[model samples]
Target: MGRIPGRLPFFLETFAQSSIKSHGSRIHPERFNSTSNKVPDMKAHQTREVIFSGIQPTGVPHIGNYVGALQNWIRLQELKKEGKKEMDLYYSIVGLHAITLPRDPLQLKKERFEMMCVLLAIGLDPAHCCLFNQDQVPAHSEMAWILNCIAPVGRLNRMTTWKSQIASSKNSNSLSEVDDSMLHLGLLAYPVLQSADILLYKSTQVPVGEDQIQHLELTKVLAKALNKQTKNKNLFPLPQGIYTRQSKILNLRNPTMKMSKSNPSDLTKILITDTPEEIRKKIKSAVTDSIESIRYDPENRPGISNLIDIYQSISGQELEQVQRRFQDKSVVDLKSELIELLIEHFRPFNAEFSRLVNSREDVEKIYLAGSQKAAAVANLTLSQVKKHIGLD
Candidate 1:
């Protein structure tokens, strides 16, 4: 189908009419036409780019987390302000995904709330974006089950994430490794759920990190397969990956490993809730060579490059610009500048975090309301899928 002009007005009109009819109210033709004409220029801004992205609710995010993912989300929110496009942005706290590994139930629940606060702290306005827990919307799991039935077991086996986790676990002395049967169906079918999370919302664009490109491809494959299997024409649009330019932030101590919440060393990852003193100390002790000159070579000088990338990402400065700025500076000077930059950037976030954490009741209320709003759309799509598959 060709693109519709003034699509927002058309949609709003359809919704208003449906709502009025459902309520047994008389139709007002003039009101409908008046609203439609008011948005004639909306055609220029109409692009069906509904973006969806999620983060596992493991704990508070770090500097790398903000630069790599949340920063892009903030930029997209700003586009809405600029009237760039009519975006229906959904950012999920995927608590379901966090359970594939061992977790403390109480800590997991607390971390989920903390993550929501962090998202708001990072600048995702609830007015422009939908923020909620994953499991709260039943359609995610419901659609996942439908897709799971159609997904090939062979494809699931070929997924590298599960295989790598299994290999790592086997080498360790964990109890989960000893009992092969303990590998639950959910763990094996993680990608299927992930695909459902994206396609269920009819997301047209997904901002993905480098490691998750494969999962996005799997989502596209499952979407195409589902459409074909049900003999439906263009039921689920194939989502495109919106790549972020920020490089993955590696650990402060172990330069090779990505900065992860699961890291045992507290100093290796800088949590968003970390104090200014903590951030300063962490960057000061960040692994750097004994060499004198500062450079941006990732292969030979990973530690220095990692810091440079973080600075560039947050400051919106180019690598060349950073290099020029630090031409004659030593590694210590570079570290000092980075520490001050981080301290100033995160000061507001820490204050907001305290506010959100204090008002747990308000946060819970927002989650419930957002989940209901999200579920209404997701359930509509799932119902259509069921009817198409002869399961209605």
Candidate 2:
């Protein structure tokens, strides 16, 4: 149950190897993707599904990240398992984006590794998904610079994430008091880097939360702009966003804001690895009104509604069902049920998470291998892009 962050212990390595074997097969790029599409019964020109998505290195992912995004990634892979077309997936610890704000070098390194453990612990089959640290691959930078040239400054100015930064937002990073004057070029232009991350692999589908829709829209726009100049019109797929949830999970402390790691109050977000006592404490202290009745009303009762949303998302119950189940009960009853539900929901992964985090070197090896796989695709895309743009 202990998490030792520095190095891998022998038993943890043995356990990881055995546990990962059942998760999935290694990502063979030539098998699922690669430049070639030749197969036993398939035409050479048939399109394969290339999925790309990422998360910032927030150490242990919050429950919002799980229900909103991570679970969807796993579910998508499972659904693709039943499909006829081969699929390739790329999930990244987007260190580049993480640095749009300031970060300590030492803490950033630890957080990056911790995020990797969270991904694996949550049942992302390494075999089916190429998990890499985006900062390791040089091509992402190169591609970002390329995309930056064509990306409109006006569009970047309009991004909501950037606007939040301008407003001195605490939800994303309230740790520092910041203003627009304090913002750097990288913070303003990082969405272009995001575009490069998606276009670099010609990602066919992108899994994202509600907050990322605008960023993904910018990706599509930039793709179309580049395609206009290229003789090869279909160089990029104009990646589609696969939204899995109706709404994002809001902060437990403040329902008006989205759940984020940077929120000053630790109670605002529930981490996947939080202990049962922590879970109970956070939920019991969750911000709700004294209406004495539960209803699915976001406008008047965001706190209770957010809790209901959590119950619905975790239990796979309809919103109506959750409301009805909790209607006759007190808010205490609802909090008690949610605490147990969350504890049970994450119990299966707790040991594995601790073990994976303990096996630090083994974790490094997996992502290093993934980075190599990611580089192969990045190199190919960059080559074609260079050929078109006269950079070759």
Candidate 3:
């Protein structure tokens, strides 16, 4: 994670106040209404750029997670730092999404807290951004049901994620393996819920990686389908994807695959909280070719390229810049420098993690406050959806 440059005190205070008001029980429902509200109209234009994105809180985030998503989030915060009220941003800890896969309850709870702490430590000013867990907002699931009613079953069947998950399963020996009957409703309808997540906030721009482009397209499809069904115009604004070209940071031991928490090998991913010694060992043992001369050819030299990408992402330098700096350098030299950079980057985050992990009460309060804030906005959207669909 890069340093947050400088602290903008005025913007931070304003953000905190907004979060307080938005999360407070005293805010009138009419305040969010478009007709008479003095607050800047969040929905006046067809292309409102309110941003929303999330990550499953199954485990601590690695360098790849930070570069791929969280870094973009922090940059959005910097835009808010200018006191521009035009954009409403949100970043969530999707605990509900994490449960799609089986997990230990206690460990999951702890991981969620740690993930929140990491986000905060990484300069996600909650005051500037809506930071909360997905389950905290009941309307996410509520609107999901409403959208599910309007969504075509045929569309759900066509989702690539659902098909990919089923295809990858090892239990394909039985007839039930290929059947939709065995697919859980949550798994099948997760994309609908994802659409709900975006529409609930009326988000107009979603910062998404390559993996989620299909899901975002589905969200737009569902939004349009619902509007047509209800005979209402502009019911949900189709969100544009803010695609980032950040290099894909690959696993240390396996240069071909991404660094992920779910990998069976612990050495495959570098957790932000990994000690200095752990980082050094991982990088030192990172798979690299016997070839000399460090270069950025991802296909011909994936191992060294992965390291270079990691270095460039963290340092905010270009691939060419990194290559020039490390030109004529040995693989050992590249690995050694990467270890130092990573250790320094994670130092503050690790400190913040320790503090939050120790203070369970404070973490709980933040989540509780965030949930209330998120649910307030969510409920308003759900109410409109229900009334439009005759569920009221």
lDDT of 2 by residue, 1-392 (tens): 01222333222222211222233233222333342221112122126767788888856788887776777666655554546336777889999988887788899999999998887777675566778889999999999999889989988877767656544344443423545676789988988998899988888878755557788889999999889878667888888766553356889988977787776688998998899889989999999997887777888889988998888777767577887898899888998899998888777677678887888777777788788878878887898899999999
Lowest summed lDDT across 10 adjacent residues in model 1 is found at 15-24
**What do the candidate models score in CA lDDT, each in turn?**
0.73, 0.75, 0.73
lDDT of 1 by residue, 64-171 (tens): 777777776777766665576577778899988888877799999999999987876666656667777898988899999998888888888666666545543343
RMSD (CA, Å), each prediction: 10.6, 9.1, 8.2
Off by over 4 Å in 2: 1-46, 165-179
Candidate achieving the largest TM-score: 2
List model 3 lDDT by residue over 1-392, tens digit each: 12223323332223321111112222222222332112223345234467889888978888888888877777676666565645777788988777765679999988998888777666565555677899888888888888887788887887667655554343222333466665787888888888889998888888777667778888998889878887886777888777665788888887777677777677878888899999988888889898988877889899989999888888877677898999988888899899998887777667666776787776666666666777777777788888887789
Each candidate structure's TM-score, on Cα atoms with residue i matched to residue i, is 0.84, 0.85, 0.84
| Backbone clashes (count) for model 2 | 1
**In candidate 2, which residue pairs get closer than 3 Å at backbone N, Cα or C atoms, i.e. clash?**
25-127
RMSD of 1: 10.6
